[model samples]
Target: MNRFYDIINKIENNNNEITVSEYFHRCIAQAINENEKELVDWFCKIKNDVEGELVAWAEKHGQKYILGRNRAERKTWGIQVLLGKKIKYKDTVLNIYFPTEFHENSIIVEQCF
Candidate 1:
């Protein structure tokens, strides 16, 4: 099997969801390796488009959006939220709530999506 197919298959079989940027970067890399300029360009364009949506969503909620660098130096999109901020998470018994207006230091990538 081709190495590119193998990589994609591995991603498909994984249980965890990948961020949009990660997915597109992988596609772009594979296209580059295969010398497919059109494929690479398409992935690059769509990656920007989708990531822009996430940024817009974060902005709409009055949250600060960021592209944070990981250990691998890759950029990941997320929103900054407070630790004691309001969130709607239900436990087995009931839903918990917090102060809607506050500030903290936590990056929530899931919230952006």
Candidate 2:
């Protein structure tokens, strides 16, 4: 029962699906508090590595990948089409689609892992 879990719960409550960055940051902080920094770091690193595959895939599809604070943000960027396609990287889950393109305001990816 620490503030880390509180923050994570708050994030989950705020959104139906948590973003990669949100998950990554929260778990990292929690791990440190629990003296499991290495474990959390390893978890996140694998998550990112898995995401990298999606990133490359998106690039080949021509649809831009946009990361945002909410679903609305993705809509604003016209990348809302890239949703629902969950990508699993080891134990982490990315609750969105990975596009295969990028422009100036193309994708706003969550940068945590």
Candidate 3:
């Protein structure tokens, strides 16, 4: 049986919206951890590079992406994230590091992986 599911579909959960590049990135990380050779081989056949996928995805959302840390996170631990549009709060302004969903008055992270 062809058990391998569509990588893009699997990464984009029902509640969370994910771009193709993000899916591929997470797939690579997971594939490496699991050492899934077949997965990698299949991925190679579909996309020649991740750059094109990223640029296209960014265009779709009308947002830009960067590799380094954001200004707010600069003086801190410098943990990397897929920084989105900047958001303003009642007390302060912060960048939308990632998509989120509301869960009964609580915020749940839409994990990339």
Query: What's the number of clashes in each of the models?
Result: 0, 7, 0
Model 2 TM-score on a 0 to 1 scale: 0.43
Model 1 spans with C-alpha error above 4 angstroms: 1-13, 66-113
Writing each residue's lDDT as its tens digit, candidate 3 over 2-107 gives 2233333344332223333444456565555668778676555433343443344445555555212111221121112234323231111121122123322221
Candidate 1 has its poorest 10 consecutive residues by lDDT at: 90-99
Arranged by TM-score, best first: 1, 2, 3
Please give the CA lDDT of all the candidate structures.
0.40, 0.40, 0.35
Candidate 2 minimal-lDDT segment of 10 residues: 72-81
By TM-score, is 1 or 3 better?
1
Misplaced by over 4 Å in model 3 are: 1-3, 6-14, 49-113
TM-score of each: 0.46, 0.43, 0.33
Which prediction has the highest TM-score against the true structure?
1
**Displacement of the residue 22 alpha carbon in candidate 1, Å:** 0.7
User: Per-residue lDDT tens digits of candidate 2, residues 4-111?
Assistant: 334334333223344454455555666667687554665477447535744654555443552322221122122121233233222221333232234431233442
